[model samples]
Target: MKLKHILIGVGVLLALILVLKFTGVIGGEKTEKVTVEAAGNKKVVETVTASGKIQPETEVKLSSEVSGEVTELLVKEGDVVKKGQLLCKVRPDILQSGYERAVASYNSQKATVASTQQQLIQNQANFANASATYKRNVELYNKKVISASEFDAAKAAYLTAQANLASAKENVTGAKFGLEQSGANVKEAGANLARTTIYSPVDGVVSKLSIELGDRILGTSQMAGTEIMRISNLSSMEVNVDVNENDINRVNVGDSATIEVDAFADKKFKGIVTEIASSSTSVGTASTSVDQVTNFSVKVRILADSYSSVKGGAKDLPSPFRPGLSATVDIESESLTSLAVPIQAIFTGDKEKSPSQAATATNDQSQDKQKAKLNDKNIKQYVYLFDSKASTVKKAEVTTGIQDDQYIIVKTGLKAGQEIVSGPYSAIQNKLKDGLKVEKTTKDKLFSADGKN
Candidate 1:
């Protein structure tokens, strides 16, 4: 009976040990190891992305100041023109008549001024003669050579002549002023008449022609027809983009940027920030409301010209880009020269497995400044280092610095040319540890896993 009890106890002990071994609680088992090496420094560029449109930097809209019928159109949509070049002409009959009438009016005023000046000169001469006679009569009256009434009459005559001379001088001055005003009116009319022949105000390409020959163009006014044609300097262009309110604070003038046009997908252009709006507002089309957008406008100067042509060995653009082409732009705000890692490497939770159990571990230094890690903290980061003896993996906690959307700088705990575990975290989590053995997949295996050759 005692021997039998002892045998049963031994059997139970063996069974318990077998269960523990199967559950991996008391014995080691072979695991696919993750080999790792140290990672070196990498250059990281932080950028902000935005959608924008290409536009001409300078656009001039030519319009008629004087109303007239268009008799001829000298330029087309793609024609390049110089400043003050004849663009189009209108019927000159009415303008010519008005100009002639203005000239005649000015000449009449001039004649009137001349006649008034001659009358003023005659009045002055008469006043001088009357004064001399008055002086002679006064002397004679004092000497009793003439009567007192005669001397008084001569003095009155001299005073009347002086008043006449003053009136004539004032008339001459008024006539001269009238003549000058008439001349100015004539010049203004002449200028308006000349304006009927439309001229290019800037050196640019003819972007638009609103009217053809025989179409009457109305005068430029606030309520009436204003635009007749448009000319733009297309040698250099600009990109205007509205950045969201959330990202506006991160943008500034003179930041380096890149632009890609939808029309020209193969080419990428460079630009620089030139202006930033001080205010914010919501903008959208009729189909989309997009309320609470609160976007601010930013203007970028493109470094590449749309046309790369030369005239007489001098580098110049053939034509500037059109005003309304869509573009995708990336503004580089910051860059670092030290170590960088993918943003995915920084994890905020160890929900799958606890950090303590993992062979290759990530020390969470972000928890307590003094302690290497705290179990309660959620934020976690991992990097694998080479395990030389066992040909396996080890992990460490790394402090992080500035980051963009794609990459982040590793402030501490990383070096260059070391292989770190980049993927397959779930498969290797339980078996990870310092100095554990590991095996790495080849590039062909990784590619083939995705069903790619």
Candidate 2:
């Protein structure tokens, strides 16, 4: 009986060893499970995304030049109008009165000029009579036919008439100058009065109306006046977006774009980059803060043919997109096919020696640095490559280029068809060490208890 008990004990011990090996606790199966992807050629397009408002390609802001109440508002917001069409009118009480005063002044000056001309004509006749009388008096004095008193009296009257004629001519010249001054005033007052009547400068819809009937407004001539309304060419639409300064270098005019408007959630509009601002600011407004994020303004014009479905049916209906609808734009700067890997597979490795450093580590300092990678605190970007022969992951330093939504282009240090740890971010980021034993597995299996590939 003692011998049989010993044999049963040995069998139980053997079963325990087999269980340990199966669970990967004390065998070669001990390894971290990680998801891997084979690097391959992929089509990649670099893009820069930005958010902004949809604006008309052509828009004109209307403002009054004369301050007054908006007495006559001919069109409301969203009303379509034509060039030179009457849009609104300001109260013309003060302006009309001034214009009338200028007209009266001009007419009065004209009458004064005419009266002075008549006086000048009479003075000319008087001057002619004075000269003839003076000649006759001289002849009479020479012949002694008349007394000295008569001759002197005639000469004095002739001198007085000559002075009066010269004065009359001077009065006519002064009156003509006054007429010219009054004419200038009339023109200026007329121009100011015309400004009270607003007209559409272009054919468009009134996208914005800032004034109601009888609302008082300041004129632009005096200050930054109230904007009466905005006329927009709705058929021609564009988005004015602010892109990050970091990404603005990748954007250029004539680049294709995909625009997503907040209002049209279901549709994506096609666009082309039309303009790029040379100067950068803090988004819409200028800011002087050192921490402020800089952004460049870019304009993307939505193609007319692409949005025909959303166009208004009749002249009375407004356009589909107003002047300030929110929109997001993705400008595609470039596209190419290159060897790429999932971005998730890459992570910053702590204190690891770079590939170049390790390759040419003949110097003492370089060798020391390579040896201290395990304990050094310096960090650099790296990816884990799967070695099929050893069933392990090797840390590799990689050079990367531009990336899109999913994959990043591997510029160097990687080849096509090579397996790379793609996921189980926790393992790729922290758990996997250089030459660490690893097993291929699905992303979901990385979290399983057994960790089997």
Candidate 3:
């Protein structure tokens, strides 16, 4: 009977413990723990990132000037060439025939000019003889030694000779003009023939070759001709990146940048901003319903000397750098030393009352005030300050300035060494409120004045 009574007592004690655990008698409630940080002054350096392709600083797109079949391809891709070196040759038969025709026309006009000059000289001699004959006849007619018809015939002959001389002189002038016109045509034909042979315009490597022997090319005089190849100075390189419109304002010429090429995975090249676009460029298709993103083209020139020695020693990199390689650039935009706080700490809301003020209000009144504040459109920027004495948070309105990667400059409304809630983004943004009780578990890792953690 004594052992049975001890068993009942143990069972009752176990039931009592279970009831206390379920009811709020054992543990009151769970307090939400938060991370807090003290506001201070720090240096913030902002940077912009963009992706682009590697290209030669000076690149020339070679195209044909005269349309013809390529008869000879003298140089292949990767061949080093000097200025005026023959790169390719087109069939010159057609251009040669045209040149020959022009030369023939020019020669014909020259002969005509010579013949007309000779004719003019002969006409002048005849006019002189006819004038002498006419003078002799006029004297004879006066002296009655010659008949009237003979004198009249001599005068007519003189006038006809003069007219013939004038005509011949005009013929000479016309022939000379014709000769000049034909000479111009010959020179034009010769130029066209010269176009059949392509020569390198600059001393550089043949970076690209698009045509093979027997391929036809279009003439640039008529339209944009077929691009046969490209010549680029690989000694100097650049990256062409498109920056979004919003970020372009901070980018300027002469800014320092770090470039990472996809091919050179372990290496980073130093660069400087060389150019920025003034006009915006649209990237997507034109649509009325959807908004298109606008970007500005920026050019960054690679500083080869800066990357020659990596990590205090010359790196023996394999393979040569080539055009069209993908790259990313991080351009340092701005750096500032100012009073700042963690970016997450700043929120947008009206002034929040303290825990004591909130506790004094009725439940319905507090709910109505919260609803009104939520509906209010005139919300201001604020940060939550941890009041250690009350173990609660109060909202402080703040004026802000520029921001960096992890922090923002707080212009006003908060002082240095003041502790504020910094993390658990959800609580700072929505869950945590003014006068809400919170347990401060630990302090956040503070960044140095240089913004380094």
lDDT tens digits, residue span 118-148, model 3: 9999999999999899888989999999888
Q: Which tens-of-lDDT digit does each residue in 404-437 have in candidate 1?
A: 6555677777776656665444333444566666
Which is the better candidate, 2 or 3, if ranked by lDDT?
2
Error of 2 at 290 (Å): 1.6
**Top lDDT hit:** 2
Better of 1 and 2 by TM-score: 2
**How should the candidates be ordered by TM-score, best one leading?**
2, 3, 1
- Alpha-carbon shift of residue 282 in model 1 (angstroms): 5.8
Which RMSD does model 3 reach against the true structure?
Answer: 8.7
